[model samples]
Target chain A: MNSTLLRTSALRSALRAAAPKTSSRAGLAGTTFVRSKVTLPDLPYDYGALEPAISGKIMELHHSKHHNTYVTSFNNFSEQMAEAKHKEDIQTQIALQPLINFHGGGHINHSLFWENLAPTSKGGGEPPKGQLAKAINDNYGSLDAFKEKFNAALAGIQGSGWAWLVQDTQTGGIQIKTYANQDPVVGQFRPILGIDAWEHAYYLQYENRKAEYFKAIWDVINWQAAEKRFK
Target chain B: MSAPTYTLPPLPYAYDALEPHISAQIMELHHNKHHQTYITNLNSALRSQAEAVHASDITTQVSLQQAIKFNAGGHINHSLFWQNLAPASSVDAKSSSAPELIKQIKATWGDEESFREAFKAALLGIQGSGWGWLVKVETGKEQRLAIVTTKDQDPIVGKGETPIFGVDMWEHAYYLQYLNGKASYVENIWNVINWKTAEERFKGTRADAFRIFKASI
Candidate 1:
């Protein structure tokens, strides 16, 4: 985990160093610069791997169509922002903020969500172990109790949103949080697990009986991935 | 001044009235739970906005813009939506009941079928949670009809424009029965549209069209 964190920060610093320091009309006239673009991450499992819990059709649409749209839109808006910034167009930049947040957060959330699932054959639904298990037991008495609380939060979400199990970076305690729309878990909270409550997540199979989807998702939850995040 | 509270308005027809087109379960949850939650949240946001106003807190007031817009728009849109629908068996469900509105629709799109096709296309074009509206736009003495869509609980509030009728394109509107078959939901909605209400809204003033919303406060 320490190595991974170190690598991420190192890459970020490298990118920052490569970025242009100043925007000038002469500098922009004919210069070519590298701009990083976010791309849709490949799912860890096949579309059909989750099986009876979630349909392959739904997974295909969710990943290819929905998640890809976010990635594409985020990149598009980022390009627009760069152009706006160069022109000193404050109003245009301000107007693009919400679109950037929505699509960028959607990309971040879905990327994490894909990593947090695995086929049942590949340790999906396996219970948490070691430190993660102890934390769950300490926080909510039992894993069953924790899941019940998580499911309740998932069910209570209005319209399109996600429910997350997050760890406080400061206190190192876990809590369930709900975000409206594509709002991501940020600030002091580190997202350990997230379940999308958007209709597109389960409407193909569960329809309006979202409680069924919420309950059934447990069968395919990649707890090992969650446990890693918990650490 | 105190913030005005809003309440959920009852559906104009029974839950099962839409029948095989839309399920009773969908209607019950959509109306009782989904619509009710919006009103509850709207009232809460209004109260918060009122406190912010009293305290002269511009920052808090700005922060509450989204909550107020989402919840209030939800309340207003759903209020109009309930009145916009009728049981398929009712006389109001027939387009002929709205002769003037039908005439306008025909005039706008060459024929009623063409108009419906355009509306259906607009409904399906929406990528996420939203509403599809057929609105009346009046520019001086010239009145025109147009189809428009609003994203995420935004209401039709343009000056000189009034919603003739709107179809809820949100997933909750048909996902229970239609699931991902959004095209079918859009196709079937025309069957339950209350043309009687459409005619009244077409002929009446904006205040008259929004009277149901006023009654909810």
Candidate 2:
């Protein structure tokens, strides 16, 4: 959010908070709300950073065009949801869920997705070092085994989706899961890693050879990036 | 003995049956490869999920819903899909002139041409990978042909609607043959529709509804 939008949002929140508590008006009936405008986060590396595994063209389009659209749509939906909630419009709020899930996932999944890759020169694809390494060993037997399972999960998504390694919050264990069409990790799973399986993610470069795409993506997996989240 | 896993259902016709409209290559890949992958993963998820539940592994059980739903919906949807199509013989014998079915379709859509336009428009309107369906569903007291779509592999049954027929709109369904032009895929698929199967399904559901109504009376 820009500084101007920040000030406006703060002012709106203040005005709502100052409204009479005894009022029966729809908007004033609700407590003060501070809704943040979601903006697309910049990639940590150049578009061409993860060369050979992913192309600069795919990165640029995926980030600027695809991810940006998600951010823009999420913001729009967020604004609508805020308005609906303020008026206590249950039906409208319910209707906004599908849009929220899709665009919100696009924003969150892509945000996590970009950081999960790094240039090979920046130690991308290097083996894990700390707790994540031990966890991978304990849960999946070995890093190679984890990669094999993850690749199979990726290749096996029936349509557009994502493959993830997530922490089972209840058990404090890791498991592999697939999410349909931009759905981020739901349920009790906290995602530790994710790869976009949408055709847009790899279709241009790999065509229909998704096995090749999965194979190459591992070559660019940022263990260091993953480790920080795992810890 | 072990519990039976869902096996891939074979296509009713040869890979070449839907030719020129949806090529053999697309059919083969869609069925043999894509459909099979869903079942395989579903089976895997089912096994682990069963064990997780048996052992009270709540987290694993919860996390497995996506796998179970996506792959099972893939199976259910595709199984209906194969039976939904046939060799290009025009609307099939049963529904071509099925008065009641045609009446409902016309009532809901104004006319046959209007229904086609509306159905195709709904299918084309899907934002991403999903399916477009023509389903017979009750709203208040009347059953009507409600054209709807679902994202990814969510089947119509999940939405409390009995699908009369469905068209796969996933890019994998036609990208090999139609490329980016889904309009052509939607238009051509009509030629191969197995309306006989759809009519049978429609009649069966209506009969059941009638039976319940008569029982109540």
Q: Please, what are the lDDT tens digits per residue for candidate 2 over residues B1-217?
A: 1323778877888998888788998898889987887778777888888888788999998988988999878877887888778878455733573566777888878898899899899997676699998888866666667888998899776333577788999877886666556799999988887877777667666454223213321
User: What is the model-wide C-alpha lDDT for candidate 1?
Assistant: 0.83
lDDT of 2 by residue, A1-231 (tens): 375355435433432322223235465544775654666666767789888999887798788888888878888887898899889999999999888888877887887787778788878889888899999999889999999999999877767889998888898888899988877675678778899888777755766678899999988888876787773
Writing each residue's lDDT as its tens digit, candidate 1 over A1-231 gives 465455445433432322234233244455555566766666767799998989998899888888888878888988998898888999999999887778878877887787677779878788888888899899999999999999999976656789999999999999999987788887789889899999889877876678999998888888887887785
In the order shown, the candidates' DockQ scores are 0.20, 0.20
Backbone Cα, N, C clashes tallied per candidate: 0, 0
DockQ of 2: 0.20
List where candidate 1 sits over 4 angstroms from the true fold: A1-115, A119-195, A202-231
- Kindly report the docking quality category of candidate 1: incorrect
Q: Pick the candidate with the highest TM-score.
A: 1
Residue A207 lDDT in candidate 2? 60
Clashing pairs in 2: none
In order, what fnat does every candidate score? 0.17, 0.25
- Error at A95, model 1, angstroms: 19
